[model samples]
Target: MNLLDYVLPCLWAFLACVGFGLVFNIQGVGVLICGLGAGLGWLVYLVCVNFLTGDIFSAFVAAMAIGVYSEIMARIRRCPVTGYLQVALLPLVPGAGIYYTMRYCVEGETQLFLSTLLHTFGFAAALSIGAMLTSSVLRALLPKLRLGRE
Candidate 1:
């Protein structure tokens, strides 16, 4: 894969997240934060998928990256992490999987539909679990770190 192969997707993800940020009424730096989070997440996803064996695992890693990023950004900016995290995850969502699954169902391809549906669910679950896991860990650890510093 050439540089453009990665650059283009990250760019698209950034723009898409920026657009969503605008639509969600995020102003100024918040919009930029959302866009950057998405771009970074996509880059992580791409890197993981290139080296990893499964797309689900890749999504999980990417989601964790995004989770860490969004949490840090939230702490720095004093804003809720939900907005940034939600928009950042959009690119990794299994849009194609859902579409293909529905298409197969409509076409009466039982086997294809079932497999696609299950895969889509798995991918979605991985993304959620990855992000949640990171957030939970950080929440559990940050207080301890602060106490240690004090």
Candidate 2:
């Protein structure tokens, strides 16, 4: 991919993070925090896709990492995880995949439509599962960290 591809994705992720922060009523610096989280997550996704030769799996892992990191940061800062996780997860939403699937369906291409729909749903499911699993692990580990007192 070219610079435009990288920059556009990061820009979209940042915008999504800003919207999420606004909707959630996050406090000062939360918007920046969320945007940075999203940018970092997208960077990881881009690096994995470009260098690791992995496909959606790399994206899934990147999303999970973002969720975990966001949770840790939220705990440290005593803020809501929603702001960070929602922004970080913007890159993994499969927006284009779902849009193409819906477009194919509208064109009456049944097989192609179904295939794309399945791919989109599978990608989305993987993202949700990965995020949930990471959150669970973080929850389990947080109690042992003794960071809550800070």
TM-score of each: 0.95, 0.85
Candidate 2 Cα errors over 4 Å, as ranges: 1-8
| Clash count list over all predictions | 0, 0
For 1-150, candidate 1 gives per-residue lDDT tens digits of: 999999999999999999999999999989988999999999999988898889999999999999999988888877888898999999998999999999999999999999999999999999999999999998899777773210
| C-alpha lDDT of all candidate models, in order | 0.92, 0.80
Question: What TM-score number comes out for model 1?
Answer: 0.95
Query: RMSD to native for every prediction?
Result: 2.3, 2.3
Q: For this target, which candidate reaches the highest lDDT against the unseen true structure?
A: 1
Candidate 2 on 1-150: residue-level lDDT in tens? 678988888888888787777877777887878888888788778878888875567778787878878888888798768667876787678999989998998999999999888888888887788778888887887778866721
The best candidate by TM-score is: 1
Q: How many clashing pairs in candidate 2?
A: 0
Error of 1 at 94 (Å): 1.5
